[model samples]
Target chain A: MNEALLAELRAALTPARVRTGATELGLYRRDASNIEGSAGVVCFPRTTEEVQACVRACVRHEVPFVPRGSGTGLAGGATPLDHAVVIALTKMDRVLSVDAVNRSAWVEPGVLNLDLTRQVAHLGLHFAPDPSSQQSCSIGGNVANNSGGPHCLADGVTTSHILAAEVVLTDGSVVVLGSEAWETHGLDLRGAFVGSEGMFGIATKLCVRLTQNAPAVTTMLMDFESVDAGAHTVSAIIADGMVPAALEMMDQLCIQAVEAYIHAGLPTDAAAVLLVEVAGLPHGVAADAARIVEIGTAHGARSVRIAQDEAERALLWKGRKTAFGAIARIKPNYYLHDTVVPRRALPDVLRQVYEVVERHDLLVLNVFHAGDGNLHPLLVFDKREPGVMARVHAAGEEIVRISVEAGGVLSGEHGIGLEKRDYMPLMFAPADLAAQAAVRRAFDPTGLANPSKVLPSPAGCGDLQHVPEGAWV
Target chain B: MIDLLAFAAEVGDAEPVTITGLGTRGGAVPDVRVVRAPAGIDWVQADEMTVCCGAGTPVDELVTELAAYRQTVALPAGGTVGGALAVGRADARQLGWGPVRDALLQARYVSAAGEVVKAGGPTVKNVSGFDVCRLLVGSHGTLGFIGEVILRTRPLARHSQWFHRADVHDPSDVFTTLYRPVSVLWNGSAVWVLLEGHPDDVAEQAAVASLVACEGPPALPTGSRRLVPPAQVPLLTGGFVAELGVGVVHHAEASDAAVRPERAQVLDHTVRQALDPSGRLNPGR
Candidate 1:
């Protein structure tokens, strides 16, 4: 933890690679969640050996270290809570190998989300797990959060896309978790590592599944008179035995904010908007689009629009993808939270969420992946206003409660970062949390990797961050 | 009882008992207890698309069903809804589909007492886990057990298709596309392009596949397997292609597909996870 030790670490990497200044340390202290802390020193390790060396140095010095990727995470997952060393992996970006015929990629975790696709474009293969921030987020962050995006409705979350990973455990021991060669000889330690929210160790390299680009694609944007109708449309489509690539829903508040910010021409008059996308054979694509139009009209769609070309598709998606930034532009501050439920219960959950937000006297912008039941309900607030941040937190907590009550979970993709750490008990029992914690302990016994995040403090065991409905029931 | 966890014997035909690997999936279970084999169970073939394992095995230890293949149970999402015929929970179209079961071609296991049994050889579809050998597929622990499972491997599909158009001025366009597909019986979810066949056939399809927002015709990040027709070119391509001209597809998406010790264990574990409180096998712990 001293400068001499830090200097020794700096000698391992380029001197310019290590950052120890106040401004740089401040920047590395938190992720998008804005949690505050300080790191003794931050080093960008470019190779697995350097990472091992950093871990050995930390072990030798008895200092804790946190491995960081792109800081686009909402959970403060990459935030440094203690005076630990931050081993950032952005410099290690490399697409090591692509087995085109096999449909998989071996990459260093620092590789950007979209870079893998760029590298594999020639082989008729592409990595499928895409978070909205794919352009900026690192694959490491995606692996840590088990991030899910719109396409996940059909493809699945990050855990599904990760076939194998090479991790550097906290003890400076370089042990491979999953196998690229196929089949581990013993217990599947890989399943427990994903979505551990950086509590286990650093994912240095990943073997991820890349998908074939569909031959044809069709995107649609539709407006409904009510969010309920929009929600029902998603279930109706699925029940009809059709699974679209992506089905996203946004309420009027979200639409208005996004439209105002981007001039993307989102319909402000409708109560909600559903963005639906389908892909396949040319005939199948056209047929599916026609059926969706039929369903929308029957369900009382106010209006619907289809993108005519790639430009139109970009325009249509701009609003949905940059929605967070757009809303942030409108409001000085906002609390973003994610929850997921079974697709069938979306209507009830959305309705309850609206009522709860109203009760708290807060503004809510609802944006969600409708097909998979992953909801990102943003509570807009100005932190400068006293008690507003706390109010937004409470309302946000309520929305997660509603999701859990409806047979959902506290997180679909954002992960149980520092923001939702206190709320972990709302979704899991003490024993269940302990089981997850045990998995973390097995991977990182020292508790040095991004500590004090997902689970609540032991002292506040009885504090209710999320209210279960039965508290009154 | 055959110590199903033991690993030191290779039984000949004259050996009266049957040697079973983890019981196969599909159809009914034969009535017989099993002896265990330990170190004798090992993965013999490890490649990009397929992995072959010894019968007395655990699927959970097989590659963690990672990436695009871990969504629902290979037999639909709810639970072990179907009988324990599906080993890997492979195909989305059919729960407990045929391909994963068919992958178990080579097997060597011991019988109730101490007889080694063998079925299906080392080929992709060695015709081993068939009616005679398949009776041990899902019998909990009854019948001949498994000593090995030879998997049929495949390459991941390269392309997925989303047919909706983008860049529209009016909202009606969205409505038209969303509803038009539903009106007709068109499956609107992303189109999957798992293809296998001659290079000319693949080239023909690739030539027609549009390049608007398409991502690849290149190598993938790792290894993948697909269920493709032998004669048709897949719209998308992947890495490490392997083709076995069989009529089976594995449901790699199932949570239990990569973890089932045996098809029979699927039922017992799920029921145990749901019904058993206090981790007790006996009633009213």
Candidate 2:
């Protein structure tokens, strides 16, 4: 970074807001994905205006920069590139207002995901997208990834919950997409920006839609003798026209890991377990829960259990919430892959996933939002092992191929960051990729805002280079 | 049927092209060559939970086909799929079923450069690209000429009708308190609730809602409908139906300019520049 440019950036905002120390810049270099890169400096903007000023300075200096939220993104989306400045948005945290009557909240980009729900809990409203890292992830990060959670099957993802946003473009201009109004007549620009993975611009403020708390709830756990049966039960539940608040599945490996870590009373010996929750009117919820249990049993569930109360329900969810963390006990490192297929194809896709795991001789766990067919296959391996990383990458690529071949997508919730950028071609053709690139070019014509993320660069051939012929078969 | 590829090629690098459907919304732009999808291109393919159809397919025809499967697309009653998707309007039921964007699973369109581009896929959930399928929705042909679309459909409610005569203003409370309703419409003088689902669930919810409103079920009204936000309801003087929970108001008297989302103009222009660099498709509108 040029010293003159640094001085200009310091002049644009408060001098205290800009930091060049190695210690400060080091912290902003990497996110949860651990894809580290050198950064020019770290800017902690406390307000949207301050953010605009920093963006203007970066633009004036022709500097590439990355906007970062809580650094909890699993896709290395927040990992700064070499010669890029890190715009850390943690200081912008604030809930501007909450409209209890309208059931909406105006919040700054840095507001913690769970904090929004906490702020509205008094009014019996809550933000629905509960990504496992809700405790630490920022709303802006959720918007960047279009993050989904267990309840997303019923509630939809971040894009669905978001009503509007005030964003700072790369050119230092601010644009508001969407509005407090339920129907915006113009183009759905907000929808396009939600999952762009920071390539479009940085969102300074967001107006998020809130959902009312369901009056009644039921949570149940069903153990199956085979993972295929669990997948079949998920299809049956959806086919029955029942949309559970949450429907999750955990294979034996995931159950064992969670049990060893938290002792959530999961049946480790079972091939898989389904955690289903229904919420609505008391009578309706009871009816849905009964129907789900009946379907699970008919589909070869060995045992079925319902949470006795709220405490038991909370206990049931604890294991799923912490399943990712528990995988650390199984291996020092794990690459979590997010893919989605049609509900009917879930059985075949899972079978293909296990086949890949067996081929790679790796311990992979299946824990995912099964109701919507979003699978998170955690491939556990030691990074220090010589050939293990290569095999894991190969297996991950194979899984993505299977997913796309089965008429699914490259990603379900986690945005395609550096990790999956190459695999995008497996699901999209060149024309599709070019059209997406055109949208990016329009947003950041200079290609300076979070460059080299989401869409693959034009020069590189995609993941097909690594896969062998008929490998998917 | 007009050859979309040939039309796109003819208009290649053209300064302006007025894309038209049935022109139900208004008149054509002056001093510009008009291009429209030819008749008989309408086609519909319905599966268990989704429908794929030609963009020129009439919304009523699509609705009728989905109704046969006991499923329905959550769009308005009249207009072509291309028009409804291009305008991207949501009806009263958006409170339960999401907006028009939510139903859209995939779309294929011809770009200003005459190249065919497709976004999204034929599935309920996909995060593959930049969500261009949704970006095209409500774009009003400024982006591209939508040729085909795949929409997620929902099972039709076993029982559905408007139950009126309940007096309530600002029914946001009902939305926050009760189970999600298919549609909650409020006229100037009375509230009209549309309940759909299993007979028992609908009856129980409607009974509870009526109890909360302290009124009896009234007669239903018949007429044309338009959808707007709840906040804009009080501004209207005449009788109009408002979807309370979803915050969509249906009034034929509603002004299109009033709901135009002017705040997003800059971003919309930027997107238009990218998708339609030649500025030929629906040049001014």
Candidate 3:
């Protein structure tokens, strides 16, 4: 935020690239979430070297630098920390290479997720991990959070897709982890960095695996009388050995909100809805969809509707994608918590969450990636209320604890940024936390790169805090 | 070496002390402490996974016993389980299917304070707490020593095959091409392929591989072998369109002892220094 540091950053990058102007700074203040914060300065670096230069400058001045991509993150990951430097990687977007035979692509951090799929669509190849923000979220951020989409059940998460990376270390030294050439190497650094939440470092370029897009995509919408029924249908489908490309669940509140916002003709009266998509060869998709319908009906589904064309399928997804935004129309503010439980525990977890919501007298619109047990409970709260923020935070924390107790994780893909940093003890022990810290030290020893995230502050007590557990299954 | 000696003496009194075999390759590399066997000890077997060998038992001996069944003990044959797992290393191809650490379903080790600790169960998947079995695999003997490592074994492959696309002009091209045959790539020209299905399926894939390569008349490869690393395999087939330095190959082939015909030994020494700064173990120059 100092003028000297700003001048140094401007000197390293083009003056046009460094933006601290009120309006531009305003745009980088907050991510898609309701968390309010601001950055001291924001810079758009076009090249890896430019990013390194900015990093070095920040390192020299001891200014914390937070990497920001599309800012589509809902986990408060991209929300700027006060008095910190924000490195916006949007300008670094570039699809460097596509190796179809190898089924890999080396792309800059700023390339949009959807754009990668579009580029490889003609070749019958596509990148998996299609988060709802695929159209806006950057591949770099996806790598940072190890983002997972509804289709993650079949395609796997971002960590699976990432092959290698050109990372700019905290000290601004560029090092390549995991070669484009895959080997049974010394250590699986690739595995460690995938979900490290930028606490590791900035990934300048990524070598990610590209899959042969399924020959056909079949989408269907099924309605159940209760969220429990919908969850049961999911279990049945998985139990029957049918892995849909995506199995998304929506509560009545979510369906009503999406219907009002997108007008995609969702069943507003239904207690819960399941959006199912199957992609593979034509025969395989047809068989999978048929079996899915059988499972849904067996689990007490009230209705089933299959989309016939690409246009119809797009409309169906448009409604689901807009589900979070639609809640904003209902409430002035909302806190979205990403908690995951085991797949078998989906029905029970959903039931328990509903009970907790009722007890708190809060409206929680549930939308979950059912196949993976990733629940996105959108807690509607008016921030203006005296105790609303505290209550919402408490509810969010409770949801995370429940998932953990159920043998799940705090953030499946959103990651443990400042929002979830304090809750790390729920998922990891002191020694485990120390091991993760060791990895962080190997990458960013000074803790200058995106500090105060992932590892909870040392002052927090190590003793486990017991709370009302959420239903795992 | 001096630092390692000093630390070893300082912590010499500990039990189940973590000790590394070669102190090379990360992950699944066991760090073990020397524990004297019970005076009249026969064999101490907890489950099918691991057994208590003498403190001085080499990794190769342990691997042979553990993988004596129809299945293997999830460790690579080329190296000992202890040496293979020093820094938590796994074959990239086999990692998804499972890794050496995964096969270590249970382990019994002596703690620094000489307290015996048992981890994991006979079941293939156990996630009780701490995952000490996996933790010990690559801990480099920094924590508690690995007294005895219990590991789960899988049925070994009865029929295996090797394939080579001998005519490719460049080594790196193999990495670029031949995406299938996803078993192992060595030296850049020869691909060590393994088919683990029925005998008929193995024969079928061998026939397809020959057809794809346009190799000599099709036949089962009983004696033939290939050992090219995936990254540089294309180079063996005379595919050297782009010339890369010897350093890349040296780093990639860190484990293999076979020396290259054209490249000098300087690159290997450089790589050794880069990886093993302390020069504490496995000093094979």
Error of 1 at A457 (Å): 4.5
Relative to the true structure, candidate 2 reaches a TM of 0.91
Q: In candidate 2, how many Å is residue A219 off?
A: 1.2
Residue B176, model 3: lDDT of 31
Which one wins by lDDT: 2 or 3? 2
Error of 3 at A253 (Å): 1.7
Model 2 DockQ reads 0.47
Predictions ranked by lDDT, top down?
2, 3, 1
Tell me, by DockQ, which candidate is best: 2
lDDT of 3 by residue, B1-285 (tens): 001223334334423333444333432224543322111112423222224443224556655654443334455544345455443444423422344444564444434433344543333222222233544554454434444444544434434444455554343434333222324333333433434433444555556454233222222232222233233434343222111211123222124343332211322232233323343322221
Off by over 4 Å in 1: A181-183, A457-459, A462-473, B1-285
TM-score of structure candidate 1: 0.67
lDDT of 1 at A325: 83
| Residue range A271-306, candidate 2, lDDT tens digits | 999999998767668888888889999999999989
Name the candidate that leads on TM-score.
2
By TM-score, is 2 or 3 better? 2
**Error of model 2, residue A293, in angstroms:** 2.1
